[model samples]
Target: MECFRIDESGYTGFDLLNRDQRFQGATAIAIDDEEAARLIREYFPRLQAGELKYRALSRRPGNHPRLLALLAELLRAHKSVTYVCDKRFLLILMFCDYAVEPYYYERGCNFYEDGQNYGMASLLATAGPTLLGKSEFEAMLAAFQRATKEKTPAALKDLVRAAQKTKWRELPEAIGPLAQYAAPECLSAIATEGVTTDAALVVLQSLITRMEVMSDGPYRVEHDQSKNLATYHDLLCRFIGHEEEIELRQSEIASFKFPLKLTEVVQVDSKASPAVQLADVMIGAALEAANVMTGLRADGLDPEKLMPLYAEDQFIHLIPSVDFAEQKQFRRGTQAAEVIDYFAANFGPKK
Candidate 1:
């Protein structure tokens, strides 16, 4: 049976506001074991025995060129898919979905389907710091994150109180309605079934969907062993060959009906699997490229320069939207617009 190897980078496990690791990325490669070993032998000859870790290798001198070369060759020779998620932006998305969207939904509106969720999330992610004070904004997000994990009435109430205490009167006109509509009941209903904001699951879902489309028949997956392996296994089982519906407050919120071509999902040791090691390198390069694009890491090689090596559809990025160039002329709106423009110009799908 055909099998793909998978690995991930920058996992902070629901801590979307982690200061050091802001992006999470995963990669899947369809190369066979023999081919992966041959490529590793050719490009990374210095590594004699252990698994190839991009983080450690990247810190060493003269390894940048080798890493870039390996990535370029892998993209050129094999079928691969990459997914990257901006964790902070993901937190904004979760807040809009859980805290804000349900209020509108009860009134016969769907923010997600209508793209308003992205719009509001982009606004908050970009301009919230200036309007609400960076500390306040982060504290609100931290509260939401905690409430999501705890899933208790007290935690949900705290999230609502955080929103209620925001100084929305001094903010822009656009944010006024959002503040008014921020309902505690919305978060309560969402917390009923437990909220999950893990970016790894998001990345895995995207990568698996893309891989299914790329493959001719059912394929299995071999992933690098990690603490979240059981969770990953459960997620894969939930959707493989079946339609799954996600419900919020007993209402059908989202549905995944795609016929999965996945047969099995198993975790393997990277030290024993060249394919998984290659996946590690691919994901590391992708994450480093994103960090460089966002100015988080300045000294690494920019893999965006190697965009031409892969197919246009090979990479899927679940980052914040940069399409808010025409926001209102208020101070926060203008600041949001500038941030959006910068991201739109710097990082996104290269046409």
Candidate 2:
């Protein structure tokens, strides 16, 4: 049976719509046991002190080349699928103002009141960088700080409800009328069944697309573990018709008699799985690369700074060019296709 490991960057829950939201990404790598061992052995000594995986290590200057090389190796040596989201674009996709059933509105508002919505985190994260020295964002930043401290669902609803009532600071002249959206309601809709469905689309579509590209198998998916992502895991299990708890190992799935063609999903400690750690590394660079791929960083930063990370001889050379490879020919499922259409209609990132 084939195996794959998955890892993620950034939070996807209530944090997904914050003004200071980092890029949210997921990476899948198909690596065999032998190669996984080999990577662990080869990169172990070279890893910096206190570096657990890509997240901590990649933040430092000296480690950039190492991560680039690791990604290059994965690209060359294995089948991989990576998706890094511009959560800002995603928010627009989510709240595009489509008509909804009265129940859908209630669901959205209930999720908001229940503190289950993540749209605000994503929105703040999206807007924070640009308004760095601005006043209105500073006010929102303060509000965000305060909001983050609200632990109860009722407290969250109070915060969300406070949006229009609270007098917000003036926007930076440069931001223009777009800043009018500073209202709390504008940041995130209390998610409804319709909204949650839209929010889940990208994640589900990305995974389904990767599965299609990789072909059907009794494949097992091992992902990095997180407590906040319990629902996300349940969503995957629901899709595959697998109702078991996260087992963290392939042997556990095999013993349960689940079919190999259908994916068996589990979440494990990244420390226990080298491939999951490598997926972390790949996603770190990919997030910056995504900023370049999309127009987010276009006028703001020199994205070429990322070029050397995948420089020809250093790492990019190791990844196969495969100009005509049909390896990516697999098709998206219905929901995924619908999401793809929605994304394309919005500002989908360049591949």
Best by TM-score: 1
- Could you tell me the lDDT of residue 198 within candidate 1? 64
Q: Which stretches of candidate 2 lie over 4 Å from their true place?
A: 48-51, 97-194, 197-201, 242-261, 291-351
Candidate 2 local lDDT, 215-271, one digit each (tens): 455677777677645555665675577443421111111111222244678888766
TM for candidate 1 is: 0.83
Superposing every Cα of model 2 onto the true structure, what RMSD results? 12.1
Estimate the TM-score of every prediction: 0.83, 0.55
Worst 10 residues of 1 by lDDT: 247-256
- lDDT value for candidate 1? 0.70
